[model samples]
Target: MRRRGLAFIIVALMLGMLLAALDQTIVSTALPTIVSDLGGLEELSWVVTGYLLASTVSTPLWGKLGDQFGRKYLFVTAIVIFLVGSALCGLSSSMGQLIAYRSLQGLGGGGLMVLAQAIVGDVVSARERGKYQGWFGGVFAVASVVGPLLGGLFVDHLSWHWVFYINLPLGAVALFVIVAGLPNDKSQTRHRIDFAGVVLLGGATSCLVLLTTWGGTTYPWSDPVILGLAGAAVVLLVAWAVAERRAREPVLPLELFRLRAFTMSSAVGFVVGFAMFGALTYLPLYLQAVHGVTPTLSGLHLLPMMAGMLTMSIISGQIISRTGKYRYLPITGTAFATVGLLMLSMLTEHSSLWTMSVDLLVLGMGLGMTMQVLVIIVQNAVDFKDLGVATSGVTFFRSIGGAFGVATLGSVFSSRLNDDLSRVLARTRLPPGFDPAQVQQDPTAIQRLPPELAADFLHVYADAIATVFKVAAPIMLVAFALTWLIPQQQLRETTKAADLGEGLGATSAERSSLAEVERGLVRLADADLRRGFYARLGSLAGLDGIAPQGVWIIARLDGKGWVEAAELACRADVSRATGRPYVDQLVERGLVERSDDEDRLRLTGEGRVAAGRLTRSSLESLRGLVADWGDSPQLKRLCERITPELLGARADRPR
Candidate 1:
């Protein structure tokens, strides 16, 4: 349709994306207050971990469901589920209840993020979709930067409950706009979803997360409960492997492991996720509890990290795009991450905010450099048929890594803090009737103590956080070691390194090989156009006489083959009277011809030659987008297939 209608649809989709993306980071700052209100400081990580685990497991299911069914109503259902979860979370009275609700919310959040991207393929054509996909990616970047700050604002100024409640109004607006503006899905393709694999994998992951979360903190290492979970984890993992091998469409194909690149990327991705999530979860506690900062200021303190991550991600992508060599990035990235985590481990209650900022910035930059490149490496490594699954698989490992990271590190923090608190509380005298358990459950309770006692408790909190990072640092070193196994692969011309948005907001939307290429090309084209792309392309095509609009007309006719002369002006978005002169000029230049009846227009022999030249020009310019990728037959064929569509009238426009 109309531009207005498309605009509304996009707005609604963006809002849905924003809600899902925001929830991922918004709760980080709020976690402190949430624990203060609900008790169970030991369970703090689960609030984020539950959401992550649920979302990661559900992503494949949602993607397959949307394909088997239609995305429109499924997306609507996802929004409803998300809203309901948000409502329940806001009303939760216990840590357990909040964690469960967050998981429920995560189920919908997965759908929202995946479906929103999938919906774009439905609403926009391949040639023009690149720019729209970029917009969606942009939504993720904005969410990453704003989610924490917004969460802090709600927790400090409003109630912590408002963090979840905020989704209500936004979800309602998105729901309304989507229903009104989105078209009905007419797709009938069916897919066999790997239900058994999903179930087994989910069970396996849950067992693993719980084992890590409770191993030292909730139960002794030798506790039967812990041992049983370990046994269950191994058994479930074996079962999942069997299910994946037998299933027609596995959640994560076992065959991917055979590819050295895929295996290495997944390993590195997992470690990055582990470190990134561990930091995101605990840094706020350090700020609010140890540094005595407000929730909002804690969020503000995170900006240096965000800036560093975003900056390095872009810089790394551009460098890869230009050089077409990326093996060194992961190696460099992991090194930075290991050092950063080590730096973070050194932080104490006496540390300055400036020192923390530098440490966080370094960590963010390292993660930013590493995370975005993994997907690109996987995409280039796998066969075309594995494109979608490979892309999602790498990110899937990252999410799982994050879950494990938070749980594992949280266990470290809880164990250390409890031990220290027990020993210190026994030696020091407290006011009559003050319960030591209160201090164990809430760091804020330390402020109720005498000044000297409170300072000691803050030191305990600070030391525990430091130990968490200390444990995390070596894990990143493992990722650094794993990166060496990733053999340097040639960057295919069609392989576009993910931009800041896609890198930050990793989505599970599966597209065909050509579709992926087209999306990347369109994004490259949009970026190029802003820098006088068409003029350069026209010069390359030897059409210096034609304006950019004229080049568009030539491409339009070439793509359509022929068009009714009477409809040309409207298709061109110009008036018939005003367009006649332009048509005559093309005819005079021998680039176009009128039919015998003069009611239709078609490219002349000379016009066809110009179109062919223009196609070559388009391909050349596209190659320029990835500067160093040498010429290839595959690149030429892809460029030819999409150039006309890229230059023609948008497929979604009103006829």
Candidate 2:
């Protein structure tokens, strides 16, 4: 494809991503106004909870459907659903109507985020994807900062309804650009949709989300409704697991959990999502209720955190791209997050805005280091065939985590606030018509209260919020521990051909040529040149017995961190039958060992040492090759311009 066309498609996809991302926070600042207008203050939580429930349940389904039916048309369909739902939300006459419409919007919104990442994976090489994915992190940061401000502006000037209405023009523009720019290609392979699996998984997710949202809030933890939902969730989850094992095409493959990186990364993602979302959701409440800031001012105050996140995300991407090592980044990030949360727990009603800003910045930097890299890690770990499912799987866990975190922490906050308020109010003579419920529901209402009463309310809220943060700080420490368990895998230089196969409209002959060119490039960039350098270094390092094929296998194992024998065979372009002899050879030579389950292969300690030496040798060789070209801007420019052209020319060739 032409550069202009690819650029347009990317912009369109980002806009689509922005639409969903913005909606997650846009209504938050507008919620009080929405409740005032719609007269359903009691049901206010449903407005947010409904969207989260629908989106979480639908995320994996959209990915599976896109993989089966092809992404272009399905993605466009999602945008249309979102637009229609947005329009309906704007026109809603009641809070119940808005909540129902938001669920419909979530049905579409779920697709936007996962599909955007999958599409980028399809088009860009993993080597270059880090930089591109950094842009996504930036978009998310900007949306977080902008969404509340936009919601506040709309509520204060136009109406709370305009928050929903604003999506119309943006959605239309995204729809048009995507339809015009993205290629529509259906898969030739017949896929059986896992109908039973979908139903079971959806039910399980909905039940779990409901359990969290309602537990200790709408109902007691021991209430029959809450207990029933919890029981149903467990049953549905187990049934879904059984269904996946039997289904020909599972929506969420059971086998992915066998991979250590995928499992650990998913767990880490969930915890991070829980901590970040839980903190972000309530931080504004703290600022407005305790510090007496307006919605717009609270939004503006969040800028330092957003800036910290954006700066670190871009820097982390560059570091990962240049160094090809990402395991320690998340570990460091989690450390920062733990410290930040601990500091936040110490905040008092008298704490200055500058102190709060510094705390948030630390938290943002920690999040920046982990969030995007987790996606990249999982993408690099899985096979191309499972890419869509793997991407959506991580997203699914994160979304569920956010829902669970918010409910759990919100419950804690509510309970503490009520207890503290009651105790404080018992000691003082109350002002007439000063309803605690009204003041709690609307932070702005405190401004109209007697000054002495308002100060007490503020102090109560501040102490309660601080206790919530103290409880949350321990969660970040758990995330930090999980980060250490993720083994580092080298990022692949090329995108998997299987992922890009049908989407870009290349003919058979062009595909073959493209494949040949890509293989040649890989050999030049990864294997042949590196092996030659390693050979020379191996002799000096007393590792002279390794063959080129053995080295190739070692490289593959190192790149994947650990892979099942069948998957490793597929990656190395050999059938399982043909690959067995090679694996036997490696095992006999003591260079590879089977994991405890005896289903996967990983390098032995000796093998790891050998691999590290080879990697270092290769880097040294590349540096030597480029040594003479130092300080020459033209050489760098030429390499950049020519590399993509060499790759793109084969795609443009005629059949």
Per model, how many backbone clashes are there? 0, 0
Please, what is the whole-model Cα lDDT of each candidate in the order they appear? 0.84, 0.69
Cα lDDT tens digits for candidate 1, 1-655: 6778988888999999999989989999999889889999999999999999998899998988988899999999999999999999999999999999999999999999988988987887656677788788888888888788899999988999999999999999999999888989898458788999999999999999999999977898999999999999999999999999988878888999999999999999999989888888899999988877888999999988778888888898889889998898889889998999999999988999999999988898898889889889998888765777888898898889989999999999999998888888889887798787887777767666788878879889999999999999999999999999998877876576465666786445555444565567677765655565556666888988776666666777884566986677777676777666667877988999888887788888988888889887876676665344335456557666556666655432222
Q: Output the number of the lDDT-best candidate.
A: 1
> Model 2: per-residue lDDT, tens digit, 488-560?
8756543221121111100011111122223323323433332353345556445667554555566567634
CA RMSD, predictions in order: 3.8, 15.6
Please give the lDDT score for candidate 2: 0.69
Ten contiguous residues with the weakest lDDT in model 1: 646-655
Candidate 2, residue 432: CA error in Å?
A: 2.6
lDDT minimum window of 10 residues, candidate 2? 501-510
> TM-score of model 2 relative to the true fold?
0.71
